[model samples]
Target: MGTCACLRVRGGIRLSRVQHNKGERSTLMKKYLATACALCMGLGVAQASQITVINSEAASFVGVNSNESLGDPSNVVMNWTFTGGFNANNVHISGNLTEVLTGTFASEADIFATLPSGTLDIDQSSTGNYTGTVAVSTDVSIATPVDPAGNVSFEFYESFNDGAGTDQIWDDITIEFQEIGIQNGMVNLGALPSDGSLVTYSGHNVAGGLDFFDFSIGGPGVGAAGSYLNAQTIDPVTGDTIDTEIGLFDSAGVLVAFDDDGQDFALGGLYSMLSFGVDDPLTGSDTTPGADGATLAAGDYTLVVGGYDTNFEDLTIGVSTLADVIAGTSAGDYDLQLSYVPEPASLMLLGFVGMLGLRRRR
Candidate 1:
């Protein structure tokens, strides 16, 4: 009887050791799982949304000198050669002239010459190089009389001749020219928005008559549907919202989506809105595959903003005001707001991680 009792006690000790070891192994497994989940949550949290704004401004000038006889019937041609490439779609050429009329004439009648006027003509080459000529001529008669001293010296005179007593005519004319060009605007989106993310950017459409914003989505999983893009005109001075239109282009320069009226019905049915990866949130409409309907993908894209109904074909010269955009006029001052929204899957993963963390704590 004593031997049997000792054997039972030894069995009990072995069973207790096995149970303790099993409990320790279970705790270690739970810890390993918890660490792996925490790592995934950390990675998700690290992936935040990003945005960028970009623009360009450039200008150049030229100078010219020429001589014209007061009685000469021919126009003065001032040639201009661009020192640098005129890469902008729209180029503005302006000039200032100083004339030194230094010739002697016989009488007041000889002083009655035509005043000088000028015009500009530009030729743009296929390579974006600009070569232009400015023509100046005296179209109308000058009414200034010769001095009693038989000498004519008039500062800031449009047309002048040496006094009638002398044989003096116009000479030594100088002209200064300035040119401005607007290259299209460009921005690159290197990082895409994750789920539950919102990105925003602000820009001005004043430099080029037409504003073209090119954005490239480079990172992975960017074009998944359920993303949103929006653009509107906010008053730079008053901070008031104005009416506008927005359009999107794919990597191949194909029109993908366009919006003239946004979902904000409270603003008299004006504003612009667009969606990615889903149907129209406001109209409950399924997006078509290409025409104003598409899922954004990781690729090059473009955004065009302008006055309502502004002809996009001639974006080289965009309209200037919301009224002009509405009327289809010129390009004007505008403050733009652009944004992006993330996909639903990204949000779901984040939520699931949060719940898991809460449950583990409990």
Candidate 2:
């Protein structure tokens, strides 16, 4: 071959080798990007499918019971269907108190729930915070229950009010629940108050306004005292961790109110508790104040409670789980509100990406 032609051929071989090396590096980069995308997708799916044990419904109740409680239709019922995935096996549903009806006391009431054979814990808080017992049946299902999980049926009942004349009603009730948090369960709820913000009660010159406090289902199996949680602190203005009342609600929209005088929370299920206790005291000692005890759980929800006047109007308090906070399901339209405190890492990540792009342009 001519010398010039042979040199040209050698140059062509060198060029082809360079092209091959470039192609290999490009393929390697594509693989790395694909892996990162898959990882991000996996994390999103985990967060999307995560399960929340407690769910509260709306409140809807009509008349008041004769004994001075809310009233007859005050009884509310909500159903919680479990689909065997939660690692923990226990569950708890609690309600708030609004106003106790007072008059002729023909009967008394409480929350009734049927579970798939596990322990039951009933906590009651009024003027004095108290936790009590629940009534359970002696059925086989109640004895040896199945794992993976099952469903629970619950209802709230209260005494009837017969007006011998002095019939009165109470107000302020709220409801919430406690259950397991799982599937890569290492949840560092971190500084919740920092993320979402707490409402502070200012001066206690008067006994009314927004009270922020939380009740959660936890005692065993859950992460910490704060896990499966709800919490609230007195407004710093008041600065007196002095006792106060709160409200509770259920999916059906039943209201329950808590009282500091009696130290218990009472309200009918199926109605959102409007207000419970009066600035003034009840008249007769024999008169019955309205208080129907109950527990609850159903689906997506929002809870609100406060004094009738405006200064305390803006203060709405309650802690919620993803289940309670996020409305809607894998399907349908729902309103959800998520509050979080800002984190330094998130800000740093954004700044770093912006700087990298600026450097590339230069």
In lDDT terms, which candidate is top? 1
> Best candidate, TM-score-wise?
1
The deviation in Å at residue 132 for candidate 2 is 23
- Measure candidate 1: CA RMSD: 22.5
- Expressed as tens digits, the lDDT of each residue in 1-362 for candidate 2 is 11222113210100011123655866644543443333333323212123444332322222322132332344455456655433333323222233333322212333345557553322222232222322221111112223424665545444343343223221222222333332211111112221122211121212222322222221121122111112221222222233332244333433433222232122111111221112111212321222322122222222322322212111244532222221111111111111212233444567799999999999
Lowest lDDT sum, 10 consecutive residues, model 1, at 9-18
Candidate 2 contains a number of clashing pairs equal to 88
RMSD per model, one decimal: 22.5, 27.9
Q: For residues 5-34, could you state the per-residue lDDT of candidate 1 as single tens digits?
A: 211321010001112366587664454344
Q: Please, what is the TM-score per model?
A: 0.41, 0.21
| C-alpha root-mean-square deviation, candidate 2 | 27.9
User: Any runs in candidate 1 off by more than 4 Å, and if so which?
Assistant: 1-157, 160-174, 178-181, 195-198, 206-208, 216-243, 263-271, 277-295, 312-328, 350-362
